[model samples]
Target: MAASSAVEPTSFDPSKAYKEWEVNGKYFGDGREVALLDYIYNHPDIEQLRGNPEKILRAIDAFAQSVTGLINIGENKGVIVSDVIAQHKPEVVLELGGYIGFSAIMFGSAMKRAGGKQYYSVEKSPLFAAVATSLIDLAGLRDTVRVVVGTGAEGIQRLYDNGLLRSQIGMAFFDHHKPSYTADLKLCERLGLIGKGTVLVADNMILPGNPPYVEWVRASVEDKRAMDKAAQEKGNPNLQYNSRFVKSFEPSGMEDALEITECLGIEGA
Candidate 1:
């Protein structure tokens, strides 16, 4: 499949900038996440945020902007994924990362709005998962989004083995460990969870780009077959993908991209 680039120039609004998250050689996991819960619950308008997804999102954004920096898929990049959800209307959405439940609440609400069913958010850190669970429940998305704590591969396997992911996933979002992106995707393919109509949206493509994953998705079936011969983590080589690069900005106003890929079909099916 041919690669395409959709560029929409966006300038970060200085007024909306979040507090510098990086401090004294630390980015996250310095008790800030738990503090975020306290901040949200104690917000003067806390009642206004309850059961309101957008409002809760605003509250989270407020905390990030005024209190501390959060490693999240900010509203800017979030719109791109939401647009994809609106168009595709995936019934079951799988998110590889559920950091503090930002994307889970955002995308889970989007999925529900688009007539989708379940949204499974797999988070690696239990503490992060707990934080995400609370926020997601606050957004009134507990029924739509389910958080499973484990690494990408482990979570995928658990879901699949338990029949929660027995069929192909409608959409899968990758925002976990960068190195696990390709391997986890391969596992999905091998398990028959990535078939025609599957939409894969991978974040952090520009800040810390993933060349290997990009190359794998954009490769021709013939090229992929060649790659699988030597690859330890083998995916379905016959799967065809039309991948593209979408230029957007992070919530922090930093330039970033989401590699959006749509599986066309099996090559010989």
Candidate 2:
């Protein structure tokens, strides 16, 4: 019910000195992902990383701090999601965008500890998905986490069609293409992937801001119905939601926020 920073550490530890994510004309989709693989695989403590999730996370954090910057959730924001996973005890967790598997490993480890089932990381880029898969495996989460290479829509449809995601999604983490957040969520709704007690955690809400996604999640069923008249994504307007905003910080000490939404159930048509 309270904001994310309410329970977590509000201050980013500057002493950690995590390298800022490389930002030129582009933020990701460069050679950095593969390079990260190289860095991890080549680390001196390679053997220690084989089956240690927390150690692997620490190593990755070290790489981000001293080596090339990575666009990962980092320890700061990652801990927030991990804590939610602990409290919610979701049977299955879905990750929209897993660039090199940082969030996947983090949340997957949490899922495993919480006695959850699976963690699905849907990445648009095959290259990134491959990297994420390798890292997740290295973290000993190969059984707990699976990486799917495709757009959010494709991944959702594939999993649903395959009956892997037919059950209600206990918790979904959205960190993919910002614009697709609402569309992808709508797709999930249309497919009945969301139900009572389902939780949706959307990242990068404050830094880049997702007004449309936020509006949709927070809107009343009547308002959503009105919007659906002209919307391309015809989600279940009758579905009810209780939403809130959680303030947090980037690993690099930048300000950001996460929008958490829980499905209350279907409202009257």
Candidate with top TM-score is 1
Residue 72 lDDT in model 1? 92
Deviation of model 1 at 147, angstroms: 0.3
Worst 10 residues of 2 by lDDT: 1-10
Query: lDDT of all the models against the reference?
Result: 0.92, 0.87
- TM-score, every prediction: 0.98, 0.94
For model 1 the local lDDT of residue 176 reads 96
Q: Please give, for residues 1-269, the per-residue lDDT of candidate 1 as tens digits.
A: 64767777577787877778797888889999999999998989988898999998889999899888999998888988999999999999999989899999999999999999999999999999999999999888999999999999999999999999988989999999999999999999999999999999999998899999999999999999999999999999899999989988877777899999999989889
**Clash totals for all candidate models:** 1, 0
Give the residue spans of candidate 2 off by over 4 A.
1-9, 23-26
lDDT digits (tens) for residues 125-213 of candidate 2 = 99999999999989989999999999999999999999999978899999999999999999999998898888899999888999999
- Lowest-lDDT window of 10 residues in candidate 1? 1-10
lDDT of 1 at 146: 99
For model 1, state the Cα shift of residue 110 in Å.
Answer: 0.3
Candidate 1 colliding pairs: 18-65
